[model samples]
Target: MKCIVGLGNPGKRYKDTRHNVGFMAIDELIRRNHWELDKSKFNGNYTVEHIGNEKVILLQPQTFMNLSGESIKPLMNYYNIDVEDVLVIYDDLDLPAGKIRLRQKGGHGGHNGIRSTIDHLGTKEFKRIRIGVGRPVKPIPVVDYVLGNFSEEEQADIAISIKNSADACEMWLKKPFLEVMNEYNS
Candidate 1:
């Protein structure tokens, strides 16, 4: 089974925050695939879609951002999915707003959600799609910046990125990850 996990805090308050861009991408994927995350299990919300002979599982951890692994680990275990078949999508403050990058494996780069995931999984060999939320404009606290809503102008860019990220997820089922990365990471 191929698993796509989106990291974000759970709650209506965090719905449109920069930190929830991961959730937004997953939302786009669900819309594109015409599926609903009707099942609640493994501390998360999930739904499966069978594409050709492959089963694709889309997940949104309800355990929040910091403890995302608490949900992902159990779900992966229950589904008998390997680390290599997992792709985590989350926000990245290091890149420009709305920019997206794909990596085969890497450290968390100080993202608490990614940190938790790496810790629980015991490896960084899983795939990742980092959607840029942009750095703070000034000396504002990082927490406040990430939890803040996007600017009016940024909304457009972020929306486009979310759509593209969803498109990339669909491409994963059809091509090698390296090829998908090369095509989308540019």
Candidate 2:
């Protein structure tokens, strides 16, 4: 079994913010798969479904961005899931809008959600899918930038990125992470 955890703050207030892109990708995945996330457990919402004969769990952490691990760790523990079988999806400021990158493992790179996951999981060996939200062009504070909504043009790009990120998640279910990375990273 593999678990895909999307990191973001919960509630409608943050539903469309830049920091919630992870949630957006997960939303896309849920929609494309027609999976019903009607169940609640492990400090978030989740649903299990088979994809290409593999049981896959889709999770959206409700512990908010900084406390993401609080949701992920418990679920992983209950399911006996290995770090290698987990794919964390979140936003990245290092790349431009509409871009995505996958990695086998790495440090959080200043993302509160990833940092929290690393802390709770006790390892950075898990896989990750990063959707590029881009850094602020001017002098806005990082917090403000990440929590802010996208511009009209950026909204279009982010919509595409969200769909592509979901596609990357589907690819990971059937292919090796490295293979998916090679195919999607550029």
Residue 105 lDDT (model 1): 99
For 86-185, candidate 2 gives per-residue lDDT tens digits of 9999999998998988899999999989999999999999999899999999999999999999989898899999988899899888998899999998
Candidate 2 residues lying further than 4 Å off, grouped into runs, are: none
CA lDDT for candidate 2: 0.91
Question: What shift in Å separates residue 30 of candidate 1 from its native position after superposition?
Answer: 0.8
C-alpha RMSD for every candidate = 0.8, 0.8
Task: Provide the lDDT at 45 for model 2.
Answer: 95
Find the candidate with the highest lDDT and give its number. Answer: 1
Using all chains and alpha carbons, the TM-scores for the candidates as numbered come to 0.98, 0.97
lDDT of each residue in 120-151, candidate 1, tens digit only: 99999999999999998889999999999999
* Model 1 TM-score (2 dp): 0.98
